[model samples]
Target: MVEDYRTHPNLAKIKIVLVETSHPGNIGAVARAMKNMGLSQLVLVNPKEFPSQVASVRASGAADVLNDAQVVASLDDAIADCQVVVGASARMRKVSWPQLDVRQTAQLAMETVSADAQAQVAILFGREDSGLSNAEMDKCHYLAHIPTNPTYSSLNIAAAVQVFVYEFLMATDIKSVHQAEGYRHQLASAEQLEGFYDHLYQALQDIAFLDPSKNARFMRRMRRLFNRSQLDVKEIDILRGILTAAQRQSNQLKTLTQDRD
Candidate 1:
């Protein structure tokens, strides 16, 4: 009966995304790893070499996963529809994201899927050498890490994906009570959040708050704030409405000052 976990419907809602992978073989390896763990959704963002024979050869029997993998031009396009985005990282950034361990990340993924059928969870793996850039990480709601030796902690990208895939399979074994079925609202997608952030930034600039060149990290901090909140669609609309109101007020004040001068 435990083998039934292989056919779990929620697994289909989880997307494993690779960002700018340098080696085609690693993509193939990740595909194989995903298939082995009963997860199939794979997305590649700007891989250096793909649709290559090397990848097909490495995929071995799991060529089906490779064949179906989505190739996208940018990280945004890859994760635009996902409601929850988690970045796999080895090092913490200066502006720390809420970090999750491998097992916890799988739990979060499962909970998100259990809550909403339309929602997708994207687990992002970054470049082999640099991992995810600051910009890519900004799109993530959380950063997840595999516990490794503090002295020597780097992992091959495929290996990290395998670890996560295995954990995701293990997550299926948990009792159904742990599922987050109580969450009823449709959580905001990554693209929607990006739009709201842009509006909020423009409103900030309209009121003479943010200076992008000088205070570049300001928006990053703001992203961290809203991302952790896990805003829903309606919440985003409300916040954007507030920003619009503020922007309109700022414009009217500026017009008044100009008229007086």
Candidate 2:
């Protein structure tokens, strides 16, 4: 009873999020691994194959974690409530994120959850084959990587989950490092961020700045820049306001040009 009292609360604050997982067996193994380390609260984001015999068999004795796992449609939904989100990736991206070693990430998790008892932490794992997409990485506040041989860095999804969960369990002497202290507004949620992006894109189009045909990756690049900035709720509103003004001005200019012609 004393053991349960000590670990359960902290463990409850940490969410293990698997995004677009392809295999059922890996999901089962991940559940088993989390249970082994006194962690739970698994969230599956759009798993291709779930609730299969393969996964259930791989789960072995830790079926409860699998049974209780929450399934969500998108990565954003999976981590919408989390204040601190760390994504696991081995491959480097064009857009730089605050990179952290696995141990550092674990310590950050400890500090974040400790500082605000209500604080939620999400550790996101990408697909089994390709790892996390660039868009997915943009959603994270930090990107965590497990050190591996330069020649071969690929790790199975389940194995990767085990490594991070182990680090989280072993983490000690955690100290809070406060960032974004001066920012008045709270960090924007995934849904809020997406809305801002949509507004920006539409405004750019209305102003004849973004050519939809030729600018497929333009928004992705913009996402990288903003993701690094970690824009807050108030900041998002400010940007959207600028976009609305730009769009309105563009429409007025277009009407004047048509009348002149």
Candidate 3:
């Protein structure tokens, strides 16, 4: 049974997600790549056009993946239950975020998924032209960068999927003694993490730290910072408690000032 399961490592964990794919051909190609690597979980978040004949033709023999693909309204919806999210990018952005090579990211993901039976790992690919936006990238716990020719680093979405999936499959084959021991820390659930962000945001608002007018930009940056940290459940709980305390203090201070006045 283990061998059978190992044969389809992608089936056990790992969701291949494409966000806002503009081309159906890329979608089909991604499906083909997933099928090639024994990956069946293909998720498309708001594709420009899906179920197109062009996609089917490009999919070649991987029509099953295309047919079974989950179409979600947003990237968050696609990876809501996922424990680990790795975004693929070819270019470096203005923001300095932690980066991982494909192999390292795969190893981390495999470790995460294997440790927790309920864990769902998501590998996200952005639009073909722009790649993953900063917002989309912020949603991921880690960033996976493919080492291509610097001059011509533009990789097709399907090609990017192939690289990551291949590494993931290879990582799964290795029976590590460490994996048997399980993860050292408990990673926060998506819901928990989101709640922490909410509390943190509210605390910032209460303290007048984040300008209400620029709240959107401020929250976006904060999200990216926290996501990159990949906080565990304990870490998130601790942070939430801290934020709660800060909010309470801020409220108390406001009350005292008003009473004094």
TM-score, predicted candidate 3 vs. hidden true structure: 0.86
Kindly provide the TM-score of model 2 when superposed on the true structure, using C-alpha atoms: 0.78
lDDT, candidate 2, 1-261, per-residue tens: 123423446667789999888989999999999998878799999999887899899999989999999999988889887767889987776667788888888887876665555667899998887888877886787888888889987888888989998887776345455433532346666567778888988888888798777665787678767866766678889999999999899999999999999
Model 3 is weakest, by summed lDDT over 10 consecutive residues, at 1-10
Which candidate comes out best when scored by TM-score? 1
Q: Please identify model 2 stretches exceeding 4 Å from their true place.
A: 1-10, 93-98, 110-119, 170-175, 179-184, 211-216, 259-261
**C-alpha lDDT of residue 22 in model 1:** 95
Pairs that collide in candidate 2 are none
In candidate 2, position 187 carries an lDDT of 60
Error of 1 at 32 (Å): 0.5
Error of 1 at 251 (Å): 1.3
Off by over 4 Å in 3: 1-11, 174-186, 210-229
Candidate 2 residue-pair clash tally: 0
